[model samples]
Target: MVSTPLPPADEKAVWVRSMFDRIAPRYDRFNDLLSAGVHRRWRARTIDALAPTGGETFLDLCAGTMDLAVAISERAPGARVAAADFSIRMLASGREKAAATPGPVHPVAADALALPFPDAAFDGCTIGFGLRNLADYSQGLAEMQRVLAPGGRLVVLEFTTPPGKVFRALYHGYFHHVLPRAGALVSHDSAAARYLPESVKAFPDVRSLARLLREAGFDRVRYRYLTGGIAALHHGVRP
Candidate 1:
C-alpha cells in the first residue's frame, strides 16, 4: 500500500509534514474514531506513567497536536511543558488548545532526531504513539537523552503487536483492516491511514526498543504492555 513517507530525510520530512498538515484539522476526531475514544484513556494512562510533578519542566517529542502535552499540563498545573513536532500545522493546532491547561504548554516545531533545545534542558520527556514514525529510533532516543537532565525520566507510549499467536492474528487483522478504514473515514486521508499500520508493523518490538533506549544513554530502561499488548509503555532515566 502507498502511504506517506517517514521523517527526517528531506523527502520523508516533506511528505510527513504535509500529511500531518492536511490531517491537523481532523486529527483529534480521527483519533476518537480510530480508537473508539480509547486513545484518550491510553493518553491519560501515559500521563500517569510520566508522573509530572508541579514546577518540573517536560518535553513532549513528536507531540502531534499536543494531546499528551495538555494532559501533562492538567496533571501538573505548575509544570512547564514544551510540545515539539516537525509538523507546523500540528503545532498550530496544539497552540489553539494550549489555553485550556493551567500550566504553560508551548508548541515548538522541532524534529526528534535533532532537537533544537540545549542539552539537559528538561526534567522529563514524553512521547506518545509517535516513536515509530521517526527516521531512526536510535537517533531519536539519543536526542531525547541529550535534552534531558541527569536523572530525568523518559516515557514512551506506542502501539505494538501482541505476542500470542492467536492474539497477534486478531490484532494484525484489526490493524491492517478495520483501523485503516476507520482512520480513512475520519481523516479522509487513506494513504496516511494505510501508513499507520504499515509503519508500526515494521517497527522494532518493545524489548528491542528498551535496549535501544539503554544504548542511547538512558538508565533503568524497562517496558510494560498495555491493553493486552496492543500497546506498550517504556520508561528510562538519563544517566
Candidate 2:
C-alpha cells in the first residue's frame, strides 16, 4: 500500500532546521549505519556524474557535516566548494569537518530557499540527501538552477521508495520501523528519526522529481535509481 503524504505543517524551513540541529552530533554516524556505508558509493556516483574538475566552483546545499563538500574538494583539487545549510549546528559540524580536509571547503550558513549568491555563481551544485527535507522542493530546485551558470549541472541524491512488491514491503518495514528506532537510538532525537520516513514518503519519486527539475528551468533532466530504487541520483543541466 502506498503511504499518504505527511501533513504540510512540518514542512516549514524553521521546523526542518530545528529538527536537524537536535541531531547534528550524531547525524553522520546515523547515516553511516543506516545506509551501511553505501551512501558513500552513492555520493561518489553523484559526484562522478557532475565530473567536477579543477578550477570549478561548486555549491553543496544542505551540506550537513560537509561530506559532499570534502569529497568534491578531494576529487577536484583545484575546485572551490561552498557548502551551505540553514541549521547552525549542522553548519558548525560541517565546518569542523571541512577544516580537517586538505582541499578548500567553505561552510556557510544559508537558506536553500534564498541562496545568498549571485545568479550563475557556481559551475555546479549538489544536494546530497537534502531535497526531501526542503519545505518547497521546487523552490529549492529553482534556487539551485538560479545559482548555476548556463551549461552548469545540478546533482541531487535522495531516498525513494523501492518499486518491487517484495522489496517495497521489506524496505518499508525497515524504513518505517527499524530505521526510526535505530536513528533515534543513535541520534538521540526520536522526532527527527520519525520525521525521516515521513519526509521521504512525502517527497516525489524519481520520475515526478525529474519533471519538477524541468519545471524549475533545468534541461536534460535524468535520473538513475540505486540500491533497488531505495535511492536515486538525479542530474539536470541549465540551458
Candidate 3:
C-alpha cells in the first residue's frame, strides 16, 4: 500500500519532531507493544554487526529512547555512545535509560540531516528505525557517513517491506490496521501511531535502500532481512 506524499521538507521535520515529542514518554513501551518486544532481537543482531570494541566513540542517530545506546554500553563497556535525536523530550527520556548503562551514554539534541559533529568524528554510527522518518532519506544517510571515520562501520536497523507476496499481504494488513491501533492503545495517541505504518509503506524496498547507501558514499553496503523482511539490518563501511 502506498502512502500519501510527505509534506515539504521543513514542514515534515517539524511534524516528525513534534510527533515524537508528543509520544516520547511512552515511546519505548509502545514499541514493545507494537513488536511484541521482538525488536530487542533485531537490535541485538545490529549490535553484533556493529562490533564496538574498547575506547571507540559511536553515535545512535534517531536514538529515540536510547535502547541501542544502552545496549552498546552494555556490550562494549569502554565505548562512548552518544544518542542524538531532534526531539528534546525523547532526549529527556533517553537520560533515564543512561543510568542503567555500563558505560556513559550521553543524550544530545541534534538533527540527523545536519549533524552537529565534526566530519569523521565518530568511530561508528547506528540508526534504529529512524531513518525512514527523515524528509530526505539519502541526505540523512550521507550525513551519517560524513560523521564516521573512514573504514568505520555504519549499522542501520529499520522497518522494511516484506518481499514475499504472502508474507507481505499479511504483514501489510496487520501493520496498517492492527499495529497502529495497538500503538494507540499503548501511547494514547492514534495519529502519531498511525504514522508508523505510513512511514514504512513509503520507505524504499531492501534493494533500493542498499543502493541508496552505496550512493551515499558507503562501500560494501549489505542488508539482512529480519523477521521475513518486516525489518532489515543494513551495514556498510565508510570509504
Candidate 4:
C-alpha cells in the first residue's frame, strides 16, 4: 500500500479534519481493533489521573467519538463536559452516547489550536489519542493549559515510543506493518490507515512529551506508560 504523506505544514489541521471526517463512521471500531479494546483502559487511567470532582467543568479536547467525555460525565455526575473537536462528523458519531450521560456532554465543533472557550474555563481537560494530529503540538499543549483553571489537571492519553529497545522494535514492526493493513481493511481508507503509524512515529515519546507539558506552563507534569509502553498517559496541573 502506498504510504500516506503527512499533511503539509500549512494544511495540517484541515487535512486532519478531513481525514477524520472520512473515518468517523468506523473510527471507534478501528480503535477497538487497533488497541484490542485496550484504549478504554488507557482512557480509564486518564480519568484516574484527573480525579475529577462534581460540579466542575471539563473539556475533552479533540474528543472524537466522545468516549472520554462520556466516561468523564459518568464519573462526575454533576460535571459538565464539552466534547470539542474540529471534525463535526466525528463529534456527530458519538452524540447519542454523550446525550445519555448523566452529566451534560455538549458537542462543540472547535479547533484544538484555537479553542472558542474563555481562559480558565475548565476544571480539567483531557485529550485521548488526538494531540499528535495537531499541526503544532506545542501550541496544542499551550491551548490546553490556557483553558484550564489554576490547579486544574490536564490528562493526555497518546501513542508513544516505548522505552525498552526490544519491545520498541516489536512494537514498531506491528505499528508500521500490521496496524496499517488491518486499519485499511477495516476502515477502507488506506491513506488514513497509513497515516496512523506515520503520525505516531513523528510524535514525541513519553519523556519528551512530559518536558513539552512542563514547557507549556503546566506544573507537576508526569507520565506513566501503559500496556508495555504501547501508549502513555501524561498528566499535569495548570499553575
Predicted structure with the largest TM-score when compared to the true one: 4
C-alpha TM-score for every candidate: 0.94, 0.95, 0.96, 0.97
Screening candidate 2 with a backbone cut-off below 3 angstroms (N, C-alpha, C), the clashing residue pairs are none
Clash pairs (backbone) in predicted model 4: none
lDDT of 2 by residue, 192-213 (tens): 8888888888789789999999
> lDDT of all the models against the reference?
0.87, 0.89, 0.90, 0.92
TM-score of 1: 0.94
| Candidate scoring better on lDDT of 3 and 4 | 4
Poorly placed runs, candidate 4 (over 4 Å): none
Model 2 scores a TM of 0.95
Full ranking by lDDT: 4, 3, 2, 1
- Ranked by TM-score, the better of candidates 2 and 3 is 3
lDDT-wise, the better of 1 and 4 is 4
TM-score of 3: 0.96
Report backbone clashes per prediction: 0, 0, 0, 0
Q: Candidate 1: deviation at residue 46, Å?
A: 1.3
Q: What root-mean-square deviation over C-alphas does model 2 reach?
A: 2.2
lDDT of 4 by residue, 76-127 (tens): 9999999999999999999889889999899999999999999999999999
Give per-residue lDDT, candidate 2, residue 74.
84
Better model by TM-score, 3 or 4? Answer: 4
